[model samples]
Target: MRSAHRAPRRLTRRHLLGLGGIAAAGVAGLAVQQLRSGQAPAEANTSPGRAAASGAPSPSAAAGPQVVAKGGGTVPYRPGRTILGSYLALEGKAFTESIALRRRQTGRDQRIVHVFYDWTDTLPARIAGLPAGATPLVSWRGSAYSDITSGGSDARIARAARQLKRQGRPLLLRWGWEMNGDWYPWGAARNDKDPGAYVECWRRIHDIFAEEKAKNVSWVWSPNWNSAPVAGWNSFEALYPGDRYVDWVGVSGYNLHRETPDALFGPIYRAFSARKPLMITEVGSMDRGGRTKADWITLFAQWVEAHPAVGGVVWFDTDTHPGYAEKWRIDTDADSLAAYVAMAKSVRFSG
Candidate 1:
């Protein structure tokens, strides 16, 4: 069933600053490397010098499940193992504090920390301070599809590519996510209802990254589970940028009502799981009607176990606007927190 309400636009660092009229944070020590005219960096390798320069774990670092793709230059995709991750809002110390609390409660370090970024925003220097071994899944919002395809945003796009390349480690980059929905400007409905424009826009950005040789990034093409307009034009197939442009296939499915994980994500899985690794890039549930949030969490774990192709799941564990009537934070109470802890501790998620 289609959602009656569109998924809320997530608050990012830029949004918070814009709302409060605060100055944008400077890039600080994060430097953007100069790109040679037409040359891109070499494809990923496991060299000691390369690893050290990129902030990747040295050979001596205690190795858990590898998130890096086998041949270097792709996302770490572990078959039969799923990685657990979360998106805690980046407000002051709350990001770090919440992460620490999760670790303390779950006895497991989150494999990924999701953060959102505006098209014009610089890569925040604070990303360097993420807990050891955590990869940052950056959800980058884009401008108009025409603006990007017409070369109007080339400078901004290249600058962002350079910054990501400078990061030097493997990270997931999800751009123009949830485009199947009508909420964001980049969505098909907002962009003249032309799905082809969305494809062209996506390819343009991916090509720019390729030109910069930002090979450390794994491109995640994500859509909301249900289309907003629920029409043929906005279907998942129409919005997809094709396999060559995407490294990971993902969907944002939230349990706003009493839907089970299968009900929320099964269609997406059947459609795209065979094409590439799947990631539930954004997922959260609230206790609704008569269902308990803890029971939903337990069922979600079971769903992941049954669906072996799902390589990762990032929980949207932050309280959102009250108008949405959703408190998505996992640790809302003892029972809910315990269920989440059990899910985290399960061997199925040990990626």
Candidate 2:
């Protein structure tokens, strides 16, 4: 991983562009100013403009190599080995210990440690406990996505933002993610009463975080890859709270049907990658075709090489849930694990 902070080298247009957003801010500022300037809830509807870890090395502590991380702070694009990450867990085990064990078993230094944070959880303590170097990419899910729009959970949400801010370090915060789908209660399929509720809720949550000055968070706006196969729902565009409100665009894509990354997720990947750095926040391949899971990993590596916009990938290591009807855990068999291990050691994955 590399620190985005660098001594100013030869200043180019790109350098100017990167320095405090003369260009990027134009778009981000539009949405921010409008959104934060106290526009009425009804009137506030609009488009927006556009970490990890631990007790280990602070970014300033490392002046040698750049370490790209997820859920930490914003990472500069390096165009090299893409970050390899995983959603690690073991029932009845402590989060930090479980994640560390899985990571060490592979003999790899994972850039991100994915975890779930429900409303009752404390974000700072959890993030701080991870293995020394891993960044926390927390999937902050509320039982209902309407909490923000309803004004029922604003306090709880605000405290979460404050907790994250209090940590005073980079952390990836994924809130009410996969809103485009209907399967989850907070998803469009059920609890999101109005189509616009998702967007409004997301914006309000983000605004509160901003109000509290929680700048250490990288707010990841994530969505499911499958189309609203259900009716009365919004598309990705409508659900999008705009670039200003978002830091990174992440997607939950899985090879449940034994398809390649491009086939299952290319459409959204293509659309969003051009606008923002992308992350396969949650991805996995099922056990299929004699060696389908392994094959998918191989193909994904190829795809990562071709797509520079893809900043990182975190594999979904959990077993298939009830609705999915697939096994996503890469360690299911020696073959699949071998494929992943080889990829981990290759130049394709960043340390």
Candidate 3:
């Protein structure tokens, strides 16, 4: 991990432009002006954003790094190693510790902790407490519309970024992830939604972060794989904000669809090849009614070898946010646990 207090580096306009397909989105000046004016939301629509953590239960800080650190600077994560991770609630340390013990028994060395923070409830407060040298990989705008900005949500985000800059570690900030799918608040799958507006708002947030000299950070652009494809929900790539703004490209998928992992991994890999280093950022085995856990483990290993560009995968291991078939409780499968360890020892992001 890099230090957060280092002097900031300016990302040249040309540098950002070369990232990909961004100019077509016309992202300049849109979000900044909205913030300068301090426009308030007059009428909150049914589809508009929600206040922070409105419906979700308060997270307990029991979750911790599954694989305890042997030393500082770098833990034992590598490519091909099974990444034994979970979508951890920021407050749950006990749950994290238990999960960590289970992973250790299987010999898994990598553990990626995920925190889904509500933009309205979490963004301001959480960023304010970022410790020195710790730039957290925050998944922003979960289960709420309050953080979803059409144009006016810039100042708040700027404040958050400033706090993150003080933390000194390069922040792997993944905002409004899985936006191309309709399952969450930020998704573009419903109502006369505008991908253009989404892109415009995304750029504004990016610009604000940049302006704050939040240089110790990289942006990850993610979207869900639309199974049972809807009319506009064919693929997430169509809603891509452009290459310039994205450092990592990922998809949220599981193994329950009619399409097998062998069949599904390749096309997505090919499509996102335009951007190097892809990930099944969120994954699990869904459906498979009464299927033994061993089967899913086999499928997981096979999926990784089949797709080399898939640099990492963060398994969602909670009993909530059920996917199509709902496999959150599949963590009990011993075979799956072994597979996770085997893969974590081999595949890690060294760069």
- Best candidate according to lDDT: 1
Worst 10 residues of 3 by lDDT: 16-25
- Could you tell me how far off, in angstroms, the CA of residue 205 lies in candidate 3 after the best superposition? 1.0
lDDT of each: 0.68, 0.60, 0.47
TM-score between candidate 2 and the true structure: 0.72
Candidate 2's clash total is: 21
Determine which window of 10 residues in candidate 1 has minimal summed lDDT. Answer: 47-56
Model 2, CA-based lDDT: 0.60
Off by over 4 Å in 3: 1-84, 89-96, 124-136, 142-150, 227-229, 232-235, 287-292, 320-330, 347-351
User: Against the correct fold, how does model 3 do in TM-score?
Assistant: 0.64
Give one digit per residue, the lDDT tens place, for model 2 in 24-49: 22323433453466531111112211
- In TM-score terms, candidate 1 sits at 0.78
The regions of model 2 sitting more than 4 angstroms off are: 1-76, 91-101, 143-146, 191-193, 230-233, 319-327
Which residue segments of model 1 deviate by more than 4 Å? 1-73, 90-93, 289-291, 320-325
Q: How displaced is residue 46 in candidate 3, in Å? A: 37
Q: Estimate the TM-score of every prediction.
A: 0.78, 0.72, 0.64
State the displacement of the C-alpha of residue 93, model 2, in Å, after optimal TM-score superposition.
6.3
Q: What would the per-residue lDDT of candidate 1 be over residues 1-351, giving only the tens digit for each residue? A: 011111335644222111111111121111111013221111111111110111111232354323333311266778778878988742233556777777888898889888877776785434744778888888888778888988999888888888988878788899988787766788897888899999999999899989988888899998876666666678887888987888888887765533445545666776666557889998876664333677668767877887877898998876643244456788777778888888888888888
